[model samples]
Target: VNQNEHTPTGTIREFVALSVRSINFVMNAFAWIIALALLALALYLLYRWGTANYDYFEQRRVPYVLPFSAYGRMLTGRLHPVDAAGEGYRVFPEERFSGFFVFRQPGYLIHDPELIKQITIKDFDHFVDHSFNISPELDPFLGRSLFFES
Candidate 1:
């Protein structure tokens, strides 16, 4: 009988066991990495969704102020100015931009596109400067412009 043929079955069993263990370890490692990647992706999506609407306000460091009254509480901050204006048109039929407060500062939330168009184009002279002490003669053309008027 050949010595190789007569080799112990115990050694063969040990080799098979070692191979299976290594395979299991590799598979588990891959599974854990995949799970971590999925978790990171989910967290990113959640962050994007949460901050989507408030991104501009966050960038400007503005505080959000909620309105009072039962109806205001129910609809406040949930509706954008455009949508709110649509509903207001049906109820109040107004054709002007509305004012609300952000912290202590007053913010004009525009609703009417035509009014906005006029303010930005035709009636720009009235709304150009927000500051009281600014002199148009000093800067002339640039000082009279709305964007840099203040």
Candidate 2:
């Protein structure tokens, strides 16, 4: 028989099937690579969460008197007035002496209770104004209270 005469009728169908199989193989490989990358990212985040240290306040506990200035409280175990103002009600919602850090400064974490109490309740005269200055003309809705104003 001649080669042309002996050729199978299913030759075109076999070629189409082979092409589809190759395309599916490439797609499955690509999908597996993407899934592996996502898994790696998730593992890295879990490792960071497990190993990171967050003991900024629990290490030290002492009673100290702070100076009478907006920024001086940071020096005497009390958080900076500016940092405290930014936190609003988040810090010390029901109590005094919340932990805070000075920006770009080392060994600037504060955790004294007495000084914080004075600044918050007893001697409000010295620390009456906020360290942050916001013009009321820009934001008319700003509260007049020193603690809540922007």
Task: Score every model by TM-score.
Answer: 0.35, 0.33
lDDT of 1 by residue, 1-150 (tens): 765664678678878899999999999999999999999999999867654554443456543333232225446666565553344344334536544343234455556788789878987777755634446888787777666666
Error of 1 at 77 (Å): 22
lDDT of 2 by residue, 1-150 (tens): 565553565677678899999999999999999999999999999866643433434456522122123245556757756555445235445534444434322132234567667667877766545555666677555645566464
lDDT of 2 at 27: 100
What lDDT, from 0 to 1, does candidate 1 have?
A: 0.59
Report backbone clashes per prediction. 0, 0
Best by TM-score: 1
Among all candidates shown, the one with the greatest lDDT:
1
